[model samples]
Target: EIDKKSDIEFTLKVSYLEIYNEEILDLLCPSREKASQINIREDPKEGIKIVGLTEKTVVVALDTVSCLEQGNNCRTVASTAMNS
Candidate 1:
């Protein structure tokens, strides 16, 4: 349920990640040639955090979908999947 009557009070931080061949990769990056490893850190003040992950800000559904499409295009699809 959504409260349409209330004012928008929160900002969402969206991050895209995909795991393939036992490696976690950022899908939202502009370059697909290099997939970097993301660091999982335990901070005393902030608790658990994922460092070096690219995040995008989205205000609407279209923006979210656009971000998803960008990530999907950057995904590394297997040759087998492409052949099929």
Candidate 2:
């Protein structure tokens, strides 16, 4: 279950099962996923931009950077299944 109020977010998980002919708490766990920040800066001397990201391993750009001093800098990226 997820409950949201104002700018706060909460998540709760509950699981119940019957054991020994009686109801009991099989599992009760809660988890949360928080957003991370990524910063991207252009390096004029290197002729390429550097991106700092978290939790995400892949980045996709639709447009091309013609002003880039280096060769084509646009390409497709895929994240590993373990990271995903």
Candidate 3:
């Protein structure tokens, strides 16, 4: 098991993003604003990343599911291709 590996430790973090009409939405942080100008940048060390994205630390299985539920509740579904 991975937990049995004393040489390595793991930390789990979750970020939910929605890409609609080429704009990024921070689903984990649903209250900032519906319209945003969030940018994606490439880092040499961390590779590609989304700026100002919210990350939630998950300790248990339910924690990850809770984060999903929070983000799902805030999802925007309207007259887009998926809804049209």
Segments in model 3 whose C-alpha atoms lie over 4 Å from true places = 33-37, 81-84
Lowest summed lDDT across 10 adjacent residues in model 3 is found at 30-39
Give lDDT for model 3.
Answer: 0.83
Give one digit per residue, the lDDT tens place, for model 2 in 1-84.
234556764443222221222322121111112112223367878765323221111123321222121112222234878667
- Give all TM-scores, in the order shown: 0.67, 0.18, 0.76
Clashing pairs in 2: none
lDDT of 2: 0.27
Across residues 1-84, which tens digit of lDDT does each residue of candidate 1 receive? 368758658887788888888777888877644447577799999998877888899999999999899889878787786588
How many clashes show up per model?
Answer: 0, 0, 0
Which residue runs does candidate 2 get wrong by more than 4 Å?
1-5, 21-84
Candidate 3, residues 1-84: lDDT per residue as tens digits?
877888996899998988866678888885766336467899999999887788899999999999999999877787877567
By lDDT: ranked, best first: 3, 1, 2
